[model samples]
Target chain A: MKTFEYRTAAGLAAGLEPGAVFLAGGTNLVDLMKLGVATPDVLVDVNRLPLHEVSGLPDGGIRIGSAVRNSDLAADHRVRTAYPVLSQALLAGASGQLRNMATTGGNLLQRTRCRYFMDATMPCNKHRPGSGCPARDGDHRNLAILGGSPACVATHPSDMAVALAAVDAVVQVDGPAGQRSIPVTGLYRLPEDTPERDTVLEHGELITAVDLPALPVAARSTYRKARDRASYAFAAGSVAAALRVADGLVADVRLAFGAVAPKPWRAYVAEEALRGQPATEERFRAAADAELAAARPLRDNAYKIALIRNLTAAVLTALAEDVR
Target chain B: MRLTVNGAQHHLVGLDPRTTLLDALREHLHLTGAKKGCDHGQCGACTVLLDGRRVNSCLILAITQQDAEVTTVEGLGRRGEPHPVQQGFLDHDGFQCGYCTPGQICSAIGMLDEAGKGWPSAVTEDDDLLSDREIRERMSGNLCRCGAYPAMVPAIRQAAGR
Candidate 1:
């Protein structure tokens, strides 16, 4: 690892600059630095910043401070009771120690687990632009199945962010320009031509908090992740869904997928297909099939389409059964 | 920089900012209880308590933990007076090679605390029972290549009662 200057800032705007990076939980960034993937000139320690609370918003929402640890966020009573999907998603990811050390903002900003990206020796467009993406034709079984480009096909690795996308969470950021809010779904940029750029945030823009809107239907939500192991592994494919049924019909629904795309894929097509439709296995499968119609699976990852389709149907069916 | 470990304060001078907490404990302080299995945080052998919570010491920089209270397996107990968890492990023979015992013990301590606080795991339906499945899921971060998990579950359950 390279030696760098370390500065502890009192506030968000204190010492942020061009090459200076904000360090929060240091789970992802520290690991990446050790792997020589992320090299920052200056490390601004943001642990002492005032952004550590999970407070209630005036609009019946909750504002999660950027530095709030993932374990604390998942254990928060309001999140557990009201936004169970978020809690379940956070618990389903990493492990107890990692969740204890990982922060909300850091979780959202974590990079993909693509082998080509992590390995400095491998040719990855995200690691070094114009180098080439080796994962496109090599070991892409765990790579992206949607929102991929010819340049890159890596999936975003955050299960928590997938749930946030389903719940319509908004991220509050403070930078040199000032403060602004970005919807969680809008926070990430698809890996199009520029796979190097992960998010829409500019350099020195620090995430302050993530606001989750109060949706009562989210209380019935859940998160299901399929992986090689029972725990402590990244999702092969996952679903975050919240369904509300009224009079044997789907009244409202929020759906999102993880480990399938460059970003947390909100299943808007499936949600659109399910609205006002009778809650049944056929309707659920059709909705899932409609959403997955855009999937262009690679040579090794064609199984993901079926896995995700079955998972989507099963999760929605389970949620729908909760009401009957 | 001054670090507080297990209640004692140590003032060290001219330490590199890039030094990880695991290196600081094992090399600088000569406290080798926290072993470095995987420096990338993949293995939990470097697990230690920071501010009463378990975290991968290998991933954390010692300079960043100047305020936290660090705890390792050595701080848990002494000769002839093992911590309840340690005693349970001994009674249940929770290891074959014992390489991952320190991490498993530290992680177990942290997991018990989390369960005590009603923190739910992914498989937790009502937070009522800390079943063997819950224990396995919670301790999934610490991998024992010797496959000592079968005995470790009862060891943890015994420790949980005490």
Candidate 2:
């Protein structure tokens, strides 16, 4: 790892200089630094910043500070009772130790777990642009099946982001340019020509908080993840769904998928198909299929389609039953 | 930087920003109780308590935790008086190689505190039972290559008074 100068940020705008990186719950950044993937010359400790609260917004929403640990957010009574899906997603992610150290913003900025991306020796477009994407033809079973470009096919490995996308969350940021609010759905970019850039945020932009708008149906939501192990592993495919069935009809529904795309894919197609439709297994399957129709799966990852279909159906079915 | 470990303050100078808390404890302070199984945080061998919460020491930079309180396995208990979790591990023989024991013990101590505070695991279904499945799921970060989970589960259960 490259030696760097470390200093605590006395204020928010102090660490937005070039070649400087904000450090908060260094679980992901430190790991990448050790692998020589991240080489920042200045480390700005953001843990001391005022971004540590999970407070209620005046607009009947929740504003989770960027530095709030994953464990604390998951255990927050407001989140558990109002947004069960977020809590479940956070818990379903990393282990107790990791969740305790990982922060909300850091979790959202997690890099892809593609083997080539992590290994500096391998040829990865995300690691070094124009090099080539080895995962396209090698060990792509866990690669992206949607929103993937020819240059990259890596999946975003974040359960929390999936839930946040489903809830229509918004991220507040402070940067050299200025402060701006980005919808969670618009936060990530497709693995297009530039796979190195994960989010649309600029070099010196810092996330301040995540705003979750209040939705009554969110209280009836849940997150489901399927992985190789029962725990402590990234999702093979996951679903975050919030449904409100009225008179056997889908009144309102929010759906998102994880580990199947370059970003937390809000299932807008499925949501459009499900709204006002009858709450039935056939309809659920058709809605999932409609969203998955655009999936361009690779040879090794065709199984993800079926796995995600089952997961979506099962989650929607459970939510529909709970509402009934 | 000054690190407060187990209620003891240790001041050090000229430390690299790349040094991890685990390296600081094992190398600078000579407290090698926390093992470094996987420096990438894949394994929980470097598990320690930061502000009374379990975290992978290898994943946190030493300079970043200047204001936090760190607790390693050595601070849990001494030989004559073992912590309840340590005693439980001993009574159940929770290890075959003992390489991952320190991490398992520190993690168990922290897990109990979390469970005590009503923090739910992924498998927790609106209850505080602390079942065997819950224990295994909670400790999934700490891998025992020797397959000591069969005994480790009971040890943690006993420690949790289940």
CA deviation > 4 Å runs, candidate 1: none
Q: What is the per-residue lDDT of model 2 for residues A39-136, given as tens digits with 9 covering 90 to 100?
A: 88888888988999999999889999999999999999999999999999999998999999899999999899999999988889998999999888
Candidate 1 DockQ category? Answer: high
Q: Candidate 2: how close is chain B to the reference, as a TM-score?
A: 0.97
Please report the TM-score between candidate 2 and the true structure: 0.99
What TM-score did chain B of candidate 1 earn? 0.97
TM-score for all models, in order of appearance: 0.99, 0.99
Q: What is the lDDT of residue A206 in candidate 1?
A: 90
Instruction: Candidate 1: give the TM-score of chain A.
Output: 0.99
The Cα local distance difference test for each model comes to: 0.92, 0.92
lDDT of 2 at B4: 99
In terms of lDDT, the poorest run of 10 residues in model 1 chain A is: A9-18
- Chain B TM, per prediction: 0.97, 0.97
